[model samples]
Target: MFKQMVIILMTSVLVNNYVLNKFLGICPFLGVSKKLKQAAGMSVAVIFVQVMATAATWPIYTFLLVPNNLKYLETIVFILVIAALVQFVEMALKKFIPSLYKSLGVYLPLITTNCAVLGVCLNNISDGYGFAESLVSALGCGLGFMLAMVLFAGVRGRMESSDVPKAFRGLPITLIAASIVSLSFYGFRGIIDNLFK
Candidate 1:
């Protein structure tokens, strides 16, 4: 069980990363990564949402959708679940962590539409993961997102201090950086297979 859990974690975080490999949550990936503090705050929000969404939506699919043959509504159900979860998080942040909430501002609210949250929930059902496995996958997805965000924050920070052509100074260079990061992650293909071999 422990070994399988490790595999799931590695696969999610490193092998099939939501941001770098799957390209699921590029909005916040690029937006919040401008500063390390902002990136960390956003990552924590996403991780919280990922775990909560997986917990909230999985049993609904298994007990409600699967048994009732309502699988066709899986996407809609997951989206609603995630949106509600984000709203809850938003409210909690506003109440207890107003500083972070204010810092996050519009980007935080935008998490409602972050496909990564819904993607993990949908994948949990589609992959037939049990509750524990779904949680592990969510952890991986969140950590992977955090990893990419923090790493790119460092990259962007360095970029800001360096000299670059005027035309490639902003979003253009950022996109190129993202592409390079994605290409690096791509090289890990079949890594899970080889690890167990």
Candidate 2:
């Protein structure tokens, strides 16, 4: 069971990364990845949102939706849970972590609508993960997202300092870099399969 949990965690973080592999949170992954500090802040916020969403939704779906046979309402239910969690997080950050709150600024609010958060919550139900499994999976996915954001921020920072063609500057260059990073994750395709086999 421990080994399987590790595999699930690794698969979520690497093989099926929400950002690079699944392509779900590209907006913040690009918008907030310009600076390392900002990327780090967003990473923490995203991870918090992911973990909390999973923790909250897993029980709700398992106890409420599944038993009630209201599975069809999952999308709506999950979104409401996520929105509430994000709002709670925003308030906590503003009151407790004011510096991070300022650093996160607008991106913090964006978490309310972040499909990545919703996607993970919904995926946990569809995958039939238990509470513990869902928590670990969400943690892995969030960390994977953070990893991508930090890496891209570093790359973009260097690109800013280095010479580049007029055609490859700005968003064009960032897109190219994103493509390369996405391609890199492809190397993990067979890893999870092999682990299980």
Candidate 3:
């Protein structure tokens, strides 16, 4: 079980990263990543939502949905769960960390519909992970998101000061940088399999 959990974690964080690899949650990835502080804040919020959503959804799917033949409702149910979690995060951030709350702007609320958060919950169910495994996977994905955001934030910082061709400035350069980052994650494709063996 421990080995399995570690593999799931490393795979999620490095191998199948939802941002750099799988391309989930691109909105916040691009929007919040302009500043390291905002990027970190958004990442933390996402991590919290992912873990909590998994905690809530796993039991609902395992104990309630499956047994009752309500599996078809998984999407709707999962969306509701994610939306609620995002709302909670938004309220907490507003009351406690207003700066980040302001910085995140619509992106924070957008987490409600963030495919990455929904993806983790649905993937947990689809992958047949147990409750603990699902939690670990969520945490791994969240950390992977943080890794990507933080790294990209630094890249964007460097780009800001560098002279660039007119055609490759602004969003063009941003997308190009993001593509490079995504390509870099491909290097980890088989690391987990190799390490476990």
Candidate 4:
């Protein structure tokens, strides 16, 4: 049980990273990652929503969806849960953490539809993770998303200060950078296997 928990935690963060490996949440990766501050804000928001969504959805799936054989309804139910969670988090942040809400702004709402968030829940179900394991995996995956976003934002910030050709000025260069980062993450696969062994 402990070993399975560890595996889920490690894999979600490194081996099966949401951004680099699964290619989820690339929209925000390119859209809101221009500045470190914005990247950090989005990361925090994602962490909050992902963790809560996982916690909430796992039970719903286990007790409600699976028992009824309504697995086909997974996408709809998961999405509804994520949307409501994001709204709740946004309101709470605005009330208690005004600065954070300002930092996150429109991006917070955008995250409601983020495929990565939905993808995490679905992945957890597909992997047959129990409640505790799913929660850990979701947390790790959220952190991993934050890590990738911050790293990419830093790289992008540097790119803004550097000289580059006109044609490859924006997304082209960013794609190249992401490709390199993805390749680097591939190295973690072997490390994950070794850790599990």
- Each prediction's Cα lDDT score? 0.88, 0.87, 0.90, 0.88
Residue by residue across 26-109, what tens digits does model 2's lDDT show?
Answer: 889888899898898888888988999998988888899889999899999998988887888888889998887787756778
- Candidate 3: how large is its RMSD? 2.4
Among these predictions, the greatest TM-score belongs to 4
TM-score of each predicted structure versus truth: 0.90, 0.91, 0.90, 0.92
Candidate 1: lDDT over CA atoms? Answer: 0.88
1 or 3, greater by TM-score: 3
Which candidate would rank higher by TM-score, 2 or 4?
A: 4
Clashing pairs in 2: none
Native-vs-model 3 lDDT? Answer: 0.90
Q: Give the least accurate 10-residue stretch of model 2, judged by summed lDDT.
A: 99-108
Per-residue lDDT over 130-157 for candidate 1, one digit per residue giving the tens place of the 0 to 100 score:
9999999999999999999999998899
Worst 10 residues of 3 by lDDT: 101-110
lDDT of 2: 0.87
**Which whole-number lDDT from 0 to 100 does residue 163 have in model 3?**
96
Per-residue CA lDDT of model 4 for 89-181, tens digit only, reads 888989998987787766788898788899989998998888898899999999999999999888888888899899988889999989998
- Pairs clashing within candidate 4: none
Better of 1 and 2 by TM-score: 2
Residue 62's lDDT within candidate 2 is: 83
Error of 1 at 12 (Å): 0.6
lDDT (Cα, 0-100) at 118 in candidate 2: 91
